[model samples]
Target: MSFLAKIFRRRPRPKLDLSHPQVVALSARLRALHAMPISSKEEVAAWEVEAEKLRERLYEDYKEVYDSLPHEIEHYLVDVDIRAKDPGYAKYQAEQLVELLSLPEEMPNQSPEPMPLKRHGSS
Candidate 1:
């Protein structure tokens, strides 16, 4: 093979292995975040921030998977961005993540029921 060809050729990306320790840890963190309760806008904002950070870590540590699944990752990120603005939507997103990850519906230390989302102008 020509040197220039080899230099410009794309390399095969590593596959995403869920059994990897780092992936397992990241998944666990995501599940824990999903189970956390948020009562106020402040809490929601904080939750969103942490979730974004986790997403960044996942992308950085698993760049191969991220690159291989651009559509899936972009869809997930967009959904999260849209839903994270409201508590109800955020909870729904979390539930969706749990389902996607195949995590147990009931996590230890998580509340048995979803918290009510307070309406605007309500006390």
Candidate 2:
């Protein structure tokens, strides 16, 4: 590779270390939130607030990872109303967030890359 190419080539970002104390605490908080019972709209509202707070913290502390997250996971982080209305879905979203933070350091494809789409009726 040429000198300029070497300098300009993108480097893979280091993965989020799940074993860090702060990450562990954040994961625990998400699990706790997932386990909470949703008995009423008030509870759901409260849950939404807590989830948003967690999302903000995640984004603030890990901006690179947050920005690189898959679109579905990012959507879950932003869509409070949908999560509030469905407890099961909220749990799933929380799980996804935790998994995101806990991803192994050596895992491949940390960066988003486009995959070829299959054309209809082209088996």
Best-fitting candidate, scored by lDDT: 2
Q: Candidate 2, TM-score vs. the true structure?
A: 0.47
Model 2 is weakest, by summed lDDT over 10 consecutive residues, at 112-121
Instruction: Encode model 1's per-residue lDDT on 92-117: one tens digit a residue.
Output: 65444442344443433433344343
Candidate 2 lDDT tens digits, 1-123: 999999899766456655556555655665555555445667667767877777777767656455444445456646656665665665465545645433344224454222222221134
Steric clashes per prediction: 0, 0
Candidate models: Cα lDDT each: 0.53, 0.55
* Clashes (candidate 1): 0
Q: What RMSD, rounded to one decimal, does every model reach?
A: 8.6, 11.5
The best candidate by TM-score is: 2
Q: Which regions of candidate 2 fall more than 4 Å away from where they truly are? A: 1-14, 62-73, 84-123
